[model samples]
Target: MSRRDAEDLEAAPDLIAEGARVLSGADIEGARFEAKIILAHILATKPSRVVINADPLAPDSISRFRELVSKRASRVPLQYVIGTHDFMGLMLACRPGVFVPRPETEVLVETVLGSLRPGRDRPTVADVGCGSGAIAVAIAHHLPGAAVHAVDISADAVRLTAENARRLGLAQSVRVYEGHLLDPLLAAGVADELDAIVANLPYIPSGEIDGLAPEISKHEPREALDGGPDGLMYFRKLVSQIEALPPRRRLVALEVGLGQARQVARLLQSGLECSAIEMRRDHGGIERIVLGFIDSQSH
Candidate 1:
């Protein structure tokens, strides 16, 4: 390591207090919470357990802890540094190229789940742009009979999604595919057979991407963030594809960017013969989810 890294490791604190102080000095918000988490990770213990036992750090462990702290202080995403993230109560493995699941996307999952029929067993669902398989895994986990087909354009995302599905014990129920949007599903002859579809596609305007926080603009993949010039390019493509599906009652749920919900809804209405269209707000009160149902008679 560098000279400064070695010195920091040598002088690393043993207790949580010192770690928190060091993180605070680095201007990391929620210093105490983050310190406890980092220490717990280095010690291979739970965060709750760390609170009950305040023990001195071993020299090796201290060095590892300091290194993790340094990475966090440098604005590496906490999830990427820790190697996992929580989504819908399930721990999902995260990596550099794959997109991280956000808390706001949970609402989209709920909307899709709520659209399920009461007596349907083994309903087929597709998660377009299934980054890291968060939505696919969560849906399969919650709805035991759901057969989830997850698609992503990025090979890295496809691999991560499969890994997460296997790790979560939903490998048998969630199928992973690599292709743009719903193309894989269509190619597999399941396009017209789907019961529901969900997507958390890229929706950030290309020009505005540079203005995003370093954690997002720098750390997250641009293909997963840039939604083209107006941020509606992918949405337009997705709506067109969904509209082409054969006449059937299928639920379609999507997560959109701020102020894009209305435009998305209009696009959906114009492109698809929707029996109903509903908008749901995220915790931040921003209209986030756009849901629509295509009735069988619309064919």
Candidate 2:
């Protein structure tokens, strides 16, 4: 019998653990969970159940598990294989082409909530380039009273964001619009009225995208990752548009690439400067968030 066939005779739990050990040694975090998920899928059982029973997997299940291990070993992002990721403590539905929401983006949400907290009133918020609706849905869930608007340049992103909003029960409050940057909201004449505008826009330069990890370079959409030349294309456009708005009590937050915080902050001209900009550090101590607020002087 093949190795897969042998597994059908109640493959030993220790054997599965062996596979997990190999993957772990290869620097794959959550090895057991990965192993369990693949095994469970092949067995047609829940991952949780796979843990409780410790039952040997069948031949087909073992074969499938090995294939997943090979893929994971190739440095494929775990989220891509699992088809979902936990962001802001929520399970967001993810897909191959959609930009995978990074954990550091949570700072953008927190910054918005912190600023809005003092007012203690419902505010209209916009998440430009709302890939996967991670930022928009998280805000809506955190502040149930807020009206959230999300827009993405990519149609695929718009569809994914809409689906995620619906899945998270924030569809009513989080409106997903398909358009570039602020176009959708401006078309609706709601740009100037926003209390907060947040985004995790593409900051990777067009040429640099090819150097990104395969999980991003090979799998994610170019329009969602490429930020044109110098990686400041979108920021320049966003800053210019935001500055034109008649000064209102508006806060703008963006997730910037490494070492781009200072440059991004500088783009906030029209009296908006670093003082008005708050820098947030990510888990890796990189300056990740550039938050600027509209003040009376800017008007």
Candidate 3:
């Protein structure tokens, strides 16, 4: 075949079509879009430009693209493969063994941001179990005067979160520590100073972790899921810790799994003696975010 004919066979559309077919066979949704995105990554070009530029992949590039497609076909999370995830309009570094930020958690962030008191400027906030620094960085980025801390049990997650904060020029604004839940903050004596605390803890029931999507059960970190028997184990633990806070009006936001919001809210209300609680639904209409406010007088 002529070189031009070879180019036609190796064009972006042809590659994406072939990839999409393979991905679809693997039961991946949005196969075409994923294929395009993978191709765009290999080509170091935008997805729209993949075809607009109509450039054929180099032989080595083709091999690399196929390798990534195979990894995805095996159910590896796309964010891990791409090395980044979009959260709150910011691209955060992601890696295997770290929790990927979900779109639903954006609602949790919005609620926290909105719930901030009018005159309480420069509030200190802690993002417990802050995987990839999504919540911590988003809060710091949006609320400039706020002090943010991101903590995680996994060293990999801590590193990724710190990297993201630095990459987004929030290294100074968002402090990251390696510890389980809020332990690091407590050690640093920042626990009582925290005006707000947000956590997207592992809420998937232990028995249900293996039943989740292959991308989650097989690829994502188990510590980032697996919430013991009733899926409220970590929430209970965090609430217990919050009880040590000094008397003050504090805002706490938590992202819970399916059908787990109400239980988590109750845990907050009773455990923290929260004066009021609010549940916010995600795009799916599931009550995914539970916010609790403990008034100073409640102490």
- Give all candidates' CA lDDT scores: 0.87, 0.80, 0.87
Lowest summed lDDT across 10 adjacent residues in model 3 is found at 52-61
lDDT of model number 3: 0.87
Tell me the TM-score of each prediction against the true structure.
0.92, 0.86, 0.94
Cα shift from native, residue 159, model 1 (Å): 0.6
- Tens digits of per-residue lDDT, candidate 3, 1-299, equal 67866775566347788889989999999998998888888777777877833655566677788899988999998888777788989988888989999999899999888888476678899999988889999999998989998899989888988999899999888999999788899899888888899999999899988888999999999999989998889998998888876788888899999998888888888888888899999999999999998898763
- In the range 1-299, model 2's lDDT, one tens digit per residue, is 67656656554445457658867977777887777776665566667777634555565555666777777667666666667777889889887778888878887788778888788478999999998989999999999899999999888889998999899888899988898889899999888788888988888888899887766777778888878888889998888788777777678888999899988887864435423667899889999988887764563
lDDT of 2: 0.80
Off by over 4 Å in 1: 1-15, 117-119
Backbone collision count in every prediction? 0, 0, 0
lDDT of 1 by residue, 58-160 (tens): 5677767778887887777888888889898999999888898999999889877777856556789999999999999999998998899999999999999
User: Candidate 1 has which clashing residue pairs, if any?
Assistant: none
Between candidates 2 and 3, the one scoring higher on TM-score is 3
Give me the candidate number with maximum TM-score: 3
Deviation from native of the Cα of residue 164 in model 3, angstroms: 0.5
Candidate order, TM-score descending: 3, 1, 2
